[model samples]
Target chain A: MTHTVLVTGVSRHIGARVAGVLAADPDIDRVIGVDTVPPSSLTRGGGGVALGRMEFVRVDLRSPDIAQVIAAADIDTVVHMSLVSAPSKSAGRTYMKEHNVIGTMQLLAACQRSATVRKVVVRSTTAVYGSSSHDPAVFTEDAEPIEVANSGYAKDATEVEAYVRGFARRRPDVSVSALRFANFMGPGVDSPLTRYFAQPVLPTVLGFDPRLQFVHEDDGVEVLRRFAVEDHPGIFNVAGDGVMLLSQCVRRSGRPTVPVPSTAFRVIGDLARGVGRVDFSPEQIALMSYGRAVDSARLVEELDWRPKLTTAAAFDDFLQSRGLFGGMPLTVIDWLATVWGGGMKR
Target chain B: MKHTDTSHDFGEQEPGTAQVIPITAARRRSAGGAGKADVEDRLADLLAFLRRRVAGEYEVDEFGFDPELNDKVLLELIRPLYRHWFRVETLGLENVPDEAGALVVANHSGTVPVDALMLQVALHDDHPAHRPLRLLGADLVYQLPVLGHLSRKSGHTLACPEDADRLMRKGELVGVFPEGFKGVGKPFAERYKLQRFGRGGFVASAIRAQVPIIPCSIVGAEEIYPKIGNLRSIARLFGLPYVPITPLFPWLGPLGLLPLPSKWMIQFGEPVRTDEFDPEEADDPMLVFNLTDQVRELVQQQLNRLRLQRGHAFPPFF
Candidate 1:
């Protein structure tokens, strides 16, 4: 039997990729893509390229009509990824709480109403663990949830997981899985990771060199696809098999990391907020202070899934694809120049 | 045999009918020692005298109250351990009251209860008055066989209010860790952040007994066994206090039992006079909680100052 999957925020980076993957699957008869905005220039379509067996629907997740849309589509599996990832502190507050928290509530309610809906996979984040000092070893699923102080993003993600877990408990037949993702980069990561390379000077919070793990965009989509088809519940840290230092990422990007004290970074973020110079906030500054390295052992052992690319290799591929690096080594002069002088102003 | 004085200088004296032993004479007597066995016996007798001075129930079978046996066993067990693992230093010996009753409250840390034992040894060996301190051990410590036997022999009792009050009333020096398990068992990230202390049990006991409460802070106990993480599931399965992954434990496995040689500085703060307050004051829950918070804040300030002064994670090796 063909499955009708309902995917939210299908116009965004990860959501679009997930929609593409599900549409390509022969067993999936239709994928309903829901987004707040109409297909923008960034949407996944060019010229005559057809979206195989998918349909796009514009529906504000915060609207009362969300349940009606899900029901009309006859969604058998709901992959809820409608969340505001804009680093702009003010922009995400209402959006995240509504779409990520209340929206999931409505989606779960819609799924409950539809007798055919059997599974739900929500894209969660490692931010639930918060930006605190973690054990050098891999943080397993069993590790206690670290307390997040001020970041709205981290707090919202934690609330989302609680809601999903609670929903599963009430509806025993529904298989709900929350994928706590680390930093992911691939073909379309032109989203967040590219900001590091484009900015003149990549600021590094001194005294804290955190281990970062990145999952390829492809792998992220594959994991979601598997979760949609399989019967599994609870939380899992979804990322590539390995981890890297943020310093290495800077080096790989051919950009220099300007070492700044934590206090200075917070000051800069605050000043930016006051002057309306940038979208960064104090909470974003706090998030940047620590790196999260989560364990993906359960995803592999239980779900029988693995990343198709390592972080280093994926990053190199991204750099090559963007034409950022062309057979040249990063030099001491490049480092000193970038460190002393801030990157070209916007 | 000659007597040598190890008593510290307190400066000036109140001339009265109170018998004052001359500092020079005490030193001379302490210096005048005979054979090693005779000196050991004298030390043992001194401990017994101190124990008797402090009024409390003594159970040699259950609590192991033989001073001679304890001194011998402690000397054997701790001396080598300290020599191999710690460069131990004690300060403010003069602050310790030579008179009968006093309460010593110290900030607690280290993976195991090693600092408590070390403090007991410091009081017995180095204090000018040569007081035998009664430490209040956690309930878990008393449940272990070898640990319980050793602790009892060393004059340690369960951390119970009744036990603490009894020991203090008898004019014995009582040591209490207000921070309890939270302070010691804290993970590596939150180290040095003192946990919430229970309402002033030490203060109540001191006030009841008209004793002075001394605030003690120990730096370097945190480094001895740094708790990196904990395996909560395993700890629950085995009914252990905490499944600690210290620098030595999980990394070194069995060999991790040997602690790294960290230099320790244990300082005794000025005593708080609880005698002025009425014993009825202990009954006021708000007063007791406020007093405990005051003591905790004072200790925290001292710890912050010490951290600034030291500046290094590990002590400098000479």
Candidate 2:
């Protein structure tokens, strides 16, 4: 078991939660949360997630200085959670890529030079299995990854996993796990897919109702924490069991679906991207049109881990936590969640 | 200005438009009670289904097999084609065990996969137990977008060893078309000739599952959409195996997609027990090939017998 842990990307919700959880654990002696920018409201040691007994360090993973921080902490466990789910408006394309791919490369290189690091857990997404006409119904762990298109988060993650594999090959003594999580949905973390669903009139491909899968942000953090503490090595898919159709999800979320023809969808996507309203990247469009599924038998059968919420429940959770990050106050959203959820139950 | 009394301009030819209230006891009772119970009952059933769907109560297998949808909705649509249009007569339903894992290896035909759907209907409707058949579909069935989810909801999975072994181990009836596209898309002149079964995969799956291989031979499907010619280039453009040039297709457009109302006969031969050999023998190519040949011969012989029994392509009755 690792005593001191280094968690990268603490500025992100999942990363902060992970660092907080590890710091609160009595067994762990120290928790070092690192990021280029200090999180806005994560008051030094404790806040929403109770960052107990933790220390925040401002270190950019893209620089060679990240190694000095790792060496100073004498960290035995490294949890890399800085991989951005989607490119943000404020963050330019170059900044996002530099933060993800270049940052991951530099961070892995730092870990390689570190003498004490024993276990490394990476936060990867299921998008590595790109959606296409040729995709199997449900991809098992043994299947090869689909060819990702250029300039998408999936492409970056694919390259990230390749680098992780190389790291594992070099350091046979250390254990490395790449957790491929489904779409993240929860109270605080608002992913782009959730934003797309939150639209009043959801757009769908003309004749496609693909099965969509989602994992709660809480479940993602728990899986990451488990890998940080435990010795489960190798790649594993993290997702709930059941899937909901995209139309079904939109309907359940109380939104009407607008069927966009092929050419119209592309045009609308380009327009949306031009003004930075939202991204309808080709990979995301392909996924929305022909939903992808992964067989995570290895998660439970081999690693002995299971997610708490199913896909439908995760969507419900997202709805319940609506308005949390989109300029809506937490107290108001909590009260709304109570009233709305209660009425729906009746 | 020609301003006249607009209300009386028609000279009382038209009756005044007003709301008619049901003031009498009989009228109100008829409006409130008559036929309301029947409508209410149907509404309640629909509401229950919707509630089940919302509450996620319907059971789906690991492979996304929705028994509720398959039994209640999808199979009902196929019943008409099975009963009246095709007038399908099925034999040796007794050979299929009432409850057990069994592999029904059938010949693929009909240019399209109408035969597979009909076979599924036969196993469900004609059998004493009314068991659903878990059809192992080809890549084409799942390669298309909406068709993939529909196929899964209709209780079919991709024809792979993982899914096959899982279904059989769960004691479900599995149906496989070993001839695949080769048997289904062949030219009409070569109709009813059993194509070469691919590499004996079904036999291997059966052997691994330790289930009996029930040879199901389907007749009259070839005549439904007689493939006079094939356009490979056009088919490749649309990502299909081949553009089957049926007599009515391409010339008739969308209206021609429908299959002909040909007479049909389905016969299930005796079970070739995989238990006769060791389960590990699934790994042996020779043993798998022998069983594959045996199943093919069984289905081909039955196909010939059924064709002779009907004596015509479009028999008046089965």
Candidate 3:
């Protein structure tokens, strides 16, 4: 069963990896990767005839012409992964509302127009759950969308989910599945998780322990692939196998972590933003102050998908793959110091 | 505002119209009180009456101490609940008088009004003084059905001058949430920032009644049900006191009302004896207002300190 898959935002990170994976799949006859800019070295192609299966289209998802481009490809399954993950750099709510929300609506409309389209998988964030300590027992497909603080990123993510759900209700034939993913981390990833590692010195809230969950980039691609092939019709918590402390991630990444008092951290985050050295908006800082533990029981049961790597293992793999852990014998020592000193003490 | 001659009523007289004087009805029945009963016997009867009223068909769970044997059931029932959910650490019980009048002013947070209840229970059960702290509840709370009944039973009265005066005259320990709506209603963006308190009603009451004012700082209440956001329309539509989006709300939707288990530290600040100050000083608006602001500011400062001292965001349970 040869299927044509249109994966958006394939110029970087999870999108690029997903495009490569889909192109490799024998089930997928053609993989059309779309991004606003042309593919760079960071993208899927290494410049060879081997890239014949994968086609790169430089079309902004936010643009109205995206529908025409997707239609031209005769896409059977739409894997919508394009989104502004960075709160600081991303366009404001107005842009998100247009690009993420309206773009999604347009993509779904175009997919619906093609009678061959069977499924649509939208990449959502666990940010919809906000910051909760409550063990959601099992974050099933039916779990209600929770509201985050009145920030534009949360609002945009929520709006995107709403559009997908609404479209699914209207077009039942087009099996729509939304993956409420936690933080994504792996080699070649440039998310907040990777950025934290790349920093020379990590700044953490002094009194607060942030319990974070991550989905490895490969695992993220796997989930998307499964969604494309499978006929699932609901939301799922697509996260890593287990959680890790933010402080631990910083220390293990071989970065010096400075424990600034929470008040002082907020002040520093503000000061850093003013000088343009760092990008910690006040909203991001507040969001980072709580535990974002999500249950992925439903994803395992329904999608038959289990996360291959935990955050700790993934972080280690990421560092090792990048050759960043080669000289840093202090990684284990830093982890020990963080754990013993109650730095990661939740 | 024109002051009326009637103690409780403050009505305006219409222009060119005769003033309607309030009629004080004489008691239809009278009882002799010259040497009828001793103070101890009268006190016991009064306590019994209060107990009967409070225990009237309500679901009373005596959390600790035998239901039949315990002298103060309300205190006993609430103590265990507080200890279980909030590991309440109380300090400076000595500041609270064993008997008689004192004004307790504490910072407020957690969209749900648990701090007031916890403090009341703490004073009643854990305090060495074993005094009942009568709280000044907002009018909005008293307007709610079940809440109104429970509040009164739990020794909360309306935050009115007359109510404060009456309670103080009876030698009851009064608690005032001076921050009122502002403190609890402040957005999640400004969690610990103390709101401006109204002119020193609490201070005037303390000075008028010649009582000490104890300022208390309550940590952990702010985090128990952290208001992450507010759905203004929903809150307004439902006529809810406040629409709070805690981690649970965003994580579990409507089920976020359940409080997180946070360790609470209640530090009672040093008492400011109103008796030491001149009675006329209470009327000196600036003096009383400054004193009240100082007390409020002190609690805010302590809360800020505790936020730094006690490490961990979203409570330890998270």
Candidate 4:
């Protein structure tokens, strides 16, 4: 049993949900959520329905002081969820990297030295397998890194996994599980990919319809809970089954798409980023261009865990939550009917 | 591990979560309020399926095989060509395994891959079991935009040892054109001449899966739009494999693009069981080469036999 749980990056939605779920677990004596900054939102009632005995820790993982927090808490299972997918408005690229790379390193170092730490769950992404012309159609868990990752969250996560491996090697007794998730989509997830889709106009590469896979925001938190509680001892790829093409996804969201040239996407993305409209990071652009997908056979066959939603189902759930053609939108349609009839009368 | 109260409480999802009604479902629900003819109803059904597919909700299997789109759009569109123009006839169809998975090693030909498409339609429509042949395609097939999505939705995957092995393991009948671009772009004179077959990769995949290899020989496809020449520079500029300069294509324009009605013959030869050899023997180059040579010779012999039996370059359909 986990006497005390130290969850990193609790400011983020996924981290907060995991912390909330763990705190609610009666078997867990204490749940501490660590974050340098504050959370973005808390109004999510259904999707963010996690509440329990979660304590807060305001410590930066880049600093050496994080070790004191882990050692002091007597944390047995350390769930590191603090890695930022993309930096917020106040922070720059350097801050995001520090929070991801440095935060993960400090947390791992603290875990390595601590005698009480027995379980470690690190949230990673499949972006480490960069998209390219040479990528296999379906990526398995042990798929090699085909292209060199120069910079971005992809590199940060790659470096984070390497350090976690190094730490695991040093302390064989500790159970380290790295979960590499695909793109996240749901009303509550609010990832850059989801944001790109939510835009009124979706820009896609002219001659590419890369396949995309997404995990529901709820499933994302649930998987973290499973890893933290269960003793899964290896790297696993997490994503809902099935894939959707880029063009297909664009149409599904009820958005008109502007087909831009492959090279021009970066310029448009940078412009969008500069104006605070969207964070079209290189990883996300590559994703929108070629798209990425991972096989989760091992997650099911080995870990004995299954997600409730398929990729299509997850996107459907997101669409429903977004209130497209549902809820009050129907009333607006009703108004349109009355106005059109009145105009005809005139 | 200590179990907790969190299991029953949070495990059950909060009620009244929203569900996105597929556009087709939404449209049909509204369309049903107004009555229509049977033909209109069928058209509405097809349109609804296409709309839902475009807006997503088309289900893909474990290997990214989209069956609904395959049946509704892609295969439905190809039915006319398979049945009417370039009508294809299968000989010794029983040589194909009726139930289990088998690797179909067919000769690739014609300026375009109408032969492969015809073979797929033949297997799908005329075969005893009507099994869909999952054709292993090149990287180009998956990289192209609109074509790529259609190909994947129609159950064509990248031709690789990993995929071939996986499909056969799943008992899915897979089709392969081992001759590849060589046979597809070969000149009219080299019509029936087989290519190198790419180092026997498909043979090894069959051996790994311990399935049978069915040697498939196709005739009458080469005569359709016979490639007399190729514009190398122009094709290179467009990033295509090669632009076939057919006798009528560049001169007559789109009219020349239409294939002449040819009586095509698809002959499936007896199966060569890979189970006889050690599954580990897939690594042995000599055995693989000998087996590949044997199959190639068998296909060559069968091709000649079918040609002799047909007795005409453009045999009339019976």
Task: Using TM-score, give the best candidate's number.
Answer: 4
lDDT of each: 0.69, 0.81, 0.68, 0.80
Q: Each candidate's iRMS in angstroms?
A: 27.4, 7.8, 23.3, 5.8
Error of 2 at A189 (Å): 2.5
Residues A1-117, model 4: lDDT tens digits: 777888888777788878888888888899887888644433443444354667777898898887898888888998988878876776778889988998888888878888889
> What would the per-residue lDDT of candidate 1 be over residues B158-190, giving only the tens digit for each residue?
776656776787788889998888887887778
Candidate 3: C-alpha RMSD to true structure equals: 27.0
Q: Which parts of model 2 are misplaced by more than 4 Å?
A: A43-48, A146-151, A303-305, A323-346, B1-40, B50-64, B97-100, B169-171, B231-239, B245-258, B275-281
Model 4 chain A is weakest, by summed lDDT over 10 consecutive residues, at A325-334
User: What is the C-alpha DockQ of each candidate?
Assistant: 0.01, 0.10, 0.01, 0.25
Q: Place model 1 in a CAPRI quality band.
A: incorrect
Ranking by TM-score: 4, 2, 1, 3
After best superposition, candidate 2 residue B161: deviation in angstroms? 4.2
Better of 2 and 4 by TM-score: 4
Say which docking band candidate 2 falls in. Answer: incorrect
lDDT of 1 by residue, A233-302 (tens): 8788888765555545665566556878877887776665565434354545544554555778788887
Ranking by lDDT: 2, 4, 1, 3
Which stretch of 10 consecutive residues in model 3 chain B shows the poorest summed lDDT? Answer: B57-66
The weakest ten consecutive residues by lDDT in model 2 chain A span A323-332
Give candidate 3 regions above 4 Å deviation.
A42-52, A87-97, A132-147, A261-267, A270-278, A322-346, B1-318
TM-score of each: 0.50, 0.84, 0.49, 0.86
